[model samples]
Target: MAATQYMTDGQGPTISMLAAGDASDMLSGYTLIEHLAQNKTAKVAQIGKLVDEQAKAHDQAQQKITDLQKEIKDLASQKKRIEALVKKYKPQSPSVGMGGVTPRMANVKTVIDQEEGPFPTIGCVRHTGDPQDHGTGHACDFMVTTGGVMATGAAKAHGDATAAYAIAHASALGIKYIIWRQRIYDLRSPGWRMMENRGGVTANHYDHVHISVF
Candidate 1:
């Protein structure tokens, strides 16, 4: 039972207990007086050698246990990081009803959030007359950075990713066109073309991605 406990639970002994038992069994029949009377120096030397071997095996087992524990911890940390990424990229609901934007535009916002999202803000619908897409509730501005500031670093990367996603799924999302970083991808033309400079970052569509849906 003691040997079984050591092997199964790894908690009862130094794991060399089995070898010690075998050594004891080898000299079981001899009394203490008989052992002392007999010149059993060679036999005693063999038992000592057996003990040394068991000690080495025990040390090796302990080191293996330590290594396994560290591996388990590393795997757990990796799992946590993967879960965080999944949550960050998961699909989220867009404010479809709050803005006067069309359902197509709202669905596009949802798909972008699912693919490259969690944006700083999304603007749609304005009273600035002229009968444009925003005034007619057909356009949305997906902001990568807040307060109309120009995108940089991760924000710029995110805006680029959003524009790329829109271009890739333009047909499916019914996107008429997208403007970002002084460039435009028109569904009718089927290519990216540089838009004439419109002054600053906000005016030139560098601060946000503009999506117009049909």
Candidate 2:
């Protein structure tokens, strides 16, 4: 009473018709496939479970990274706000006992150096031969860009901010006039007046913000 069976090599389950089973215990067709799949089912399931665990860990780590990045950005924003607040309400003291510069001009220089400046160059009390404000220690040139370069991008923006700040704080800083970007803002007139083109970056005050204090 012989029955059909399937034989296999070590590689995988393969069908080779062989008579090795009695009819009562024969494994063939659907029963044979079920028997073979059951042998490896536990191992396959274990490997899939490991893969799932690793994938979940990767996702968790990625979420943590994203959260930390957001935290850092938030902290940076808070720091900027705090710094701005400090600058806004901080009491300003005049530069005392300073020579070759007026007290008001020295205070302007001190404030700008502590805040917006550390500029490329700051020239004051220089010999202009015509007795302009520069020779009298009441003027300063806050050079935002050097090398006779016409300011663009960040330099131009910095110059604009410096000029605006000087204009805005003219009363407190005792600003007589501010010259920037070929225009002059005289506190007496309180208007921006265009000047004749001076043919160069330094001459036209394009690369520097000129401040003259009373």
Candidate 3:
């Protein structure tokens, strides 16, 4: 039998026959396998790192959503508190007998109604009054006296306080004038003015605190 040969090429087909070992070719094959294994391991490690980063990003996004929800809740609570305060302190228009009160007069009446004990009896928009703001539903009469007599003691004090409050908040309440204790305080005037004798306490406005709204 003739001796057969063996040959191999790096980039071409191989030819096999009975032959001795080729150490360089074997070493090249082993190095190629080792390189492939290393590349695979590196790729896996990179993929794991990317997955961890994605998980962290997801957690951060979820936390942000939770924080925003809490902020919305807090804002809602604050809005409720503000609304309650407005309802308690802010003036409201009267629903009943709407024809008898103007917007400004209603505001003043609301403030007076909230005053402390012994509030005066209030009357407004009387048809029998002379040609004045009362007939036009723009005036209010806070009766500080009963049966033509002037109020005394705590009643008198309450009446005084009511008048003072009205005067102090005149601009805010849109007051045109105030008459009490036989004196008149007009918004156009600088100070209280004395009136001539009207013959009686009620006639002179001493028995009532009269307020006219603009």
Candidates in order have lDDT scores of: 0.77, 0.78, 0.73
Please provide, for model 3 over 51-124, each residue's C-alpha lDDT reduced to its tens digit, 9 standing for 90 to 100: 99999999999999999999999999999998767667764323233366888798887776555223336778
Evaluate residue 101 in candidate 3 and report its C-alpha lDDT on the 0 to 100 scale.
Answer: 89
TM-score of 3: 0.52
Worst 10 residues of 1 by lDDT: 11-20
Per-prediction TM-score to the true structure, in the order listed: 0.55, 0.55, 0.52
Candidate 1 Cα outliers beyond 4 Å, as residue runs = 1-97, 129-131
> Mind giving the per-residue lDDT tens digits that candidate 2 earns over 1-214?
0122223333222232233355433445436656756756878999999999999999999999999999999999999999988776665433222458888888888777567755876777777544389877898888888799989999999988998988898998789999999999999999999999878888989988889999
Q: How accurate is candidate 3 locally (lDDT)?
A: 0.73
lDDT of 1 at 100: 76
- Candidate 2 yields a Cα-based lDDT of 0.78
